[model samples]
Target: MTRSGRLSRDAITAFALLGLIALFAAMLNNRPQTTLSGGFNVIDGDSLSRSGDRFRLVGIDAPEYRQQCERDGVHWLCGQEARALLVKLLQGGSIECRGNDRDRYDRLLVTCRTNEDDINAEMVRRGMAVSFGSYRSEENAARAARAGMWAGNFERPQDFRREEQAGSPKGQDLFAAAADFVKRLAGWN
Candidate 1:
């Protein structure tokens, strides 16, 4: 292949790697989607221990692996539960993914799903994550409607981590937050 051809091939490879990163990042970004999508099983959260390159959930952000509870006042992590749920949902089914771009941490900004279910939305509705699309209006709407991590008294999942990094309370409430999300969506109490 000519030098130009080789350069093109390398660029394609780099792009592919970046896309992969966005997929992983979406799951961690706290911007889970509520629409059906799909892709390959990429990475299994350390908690799940599953084998596959999961088409990372997009549009929402779940708690980190080193978060803490506010009531008991100790160190803890809730991301594992969220990861387990994702693994269970995959069911080895096909996952559709919406690839954006890779973040600094090398995760995909993609929307993932299987059949007709949106894992991202499920995560938020289930109160396992929040809307990390703080600056993005479209994503913000999804987050607001889902009453994601930002719905209740608890802070956004991303912010929670920031607090931990700054030596503050790592608060979370999936149950109450889910209920609040339902309510925020103008759901009948």
Candidate 2:
């Protein structure tokens, strides 16, 4: 009824309601899929265990729990430290992982995220883990900042595993060898 009038008040209200409904629908569609529910136990720096199931974090590699690194002329337990950091991250938070590939060790390779953020990405961003797959930029940033292992001298986790495999007794895993060594030194069995 006014000069060059466009939308009526009732029409504007209807349009606003429609826009809100669309936004709600889009949010629902974008919600993440539920993966698992339970408290997680740390398997290593880059893996989690829950109810006997193992989930390896996708696109990142962390040090083995027994690996060592030299920083400022001092040897540090980088592997164990990484595991501790991951454990801290999982405290009071549930993780949901999404990925279907079973790794060579039969662990589920997944991209896990907590309510706060992506667990895998956070590890790399913290410089506690090295990115593999599509997250190289994150690793680069950590390296630039000299974060975690980047601040010291240490072999990559895969290279460490390869060396251990070579030195291990035929058909015996490194973990078993470590356990056997421990048992022998402890005079158990």
Candidate 3:
């Protein structure tokens, strides 16, 4: 080919290569976007109240208040337990926060961790809460297995909420009752 023709071909190739690189960079830039924050009192295994800004836990599922234990007639209140654990672990110091911003209930979704351990995974791995499926499938499964949720029968946090929303069992509200009880204990006048 002529010199001008060869030069034109090279130019086209260079533009194409640059375009590809731009696309790859864009993908990298638009990644999942998990943020980090600190200084929240993780009051329980499942919940935490924040002082300043907080990042939400993205993928994991936590137990609901009414989630019953697979064995015995006792109620564990797995959700509440998860929050309580967070509170206990986080209160000691500034915890790590990484995840989405808000949950369905408009609370922060965060994976909190101390210098000692990750409080969020601890809850699921220890059976206080559940592994979440919406964000990552195997993440939940792995957490479930690790947490020993499979030793017997139980429900996921999402499933329990769905049933409640569907009004299938028409069960009484445990959260409201418990909150009221707590208020009474605190002498809410």
Score candidate 2 by lDDT: 0.83
What digit string (tens of lDDT, one per residue) describes model 3 on residues 58-168? 456666555664645454555665666656666766566666446666776666667767766665556555555433444456455755454445687767878776663
Location of the lowest summed lDDT over 10 successive residues in candidate 3: 133-142
Q: Rank the candidates by TM-score, best first.
A: 2, 3, 1
Q: Estimate the TM-score for candidate 1.
A: 0.46
Better of 2 and 3 by lDDT: 2
Question: How well does candidate 3 match the true structure in TM-score terms?
Answer: 0.55
Q: lDDT per residue, candidate 2, 118-163, as tens digits?
A: 8888788777888778578888898899998889888989898888
Off by over 4 Å in 3: 1-37, 41-55, 99-109, 133-152, 168-189
Question: Which of 1 and 2 is ahead in lDDT?
Answer: 2
Cα lDDT tens digits for candidate 1, 39-64: 33424321121133223445666666
**How much lDDT does each candidate structure score?**
0.55, 0.83, 0.61
Clashes of 3: 22
Ranking by lDDT: 2, 3, 1
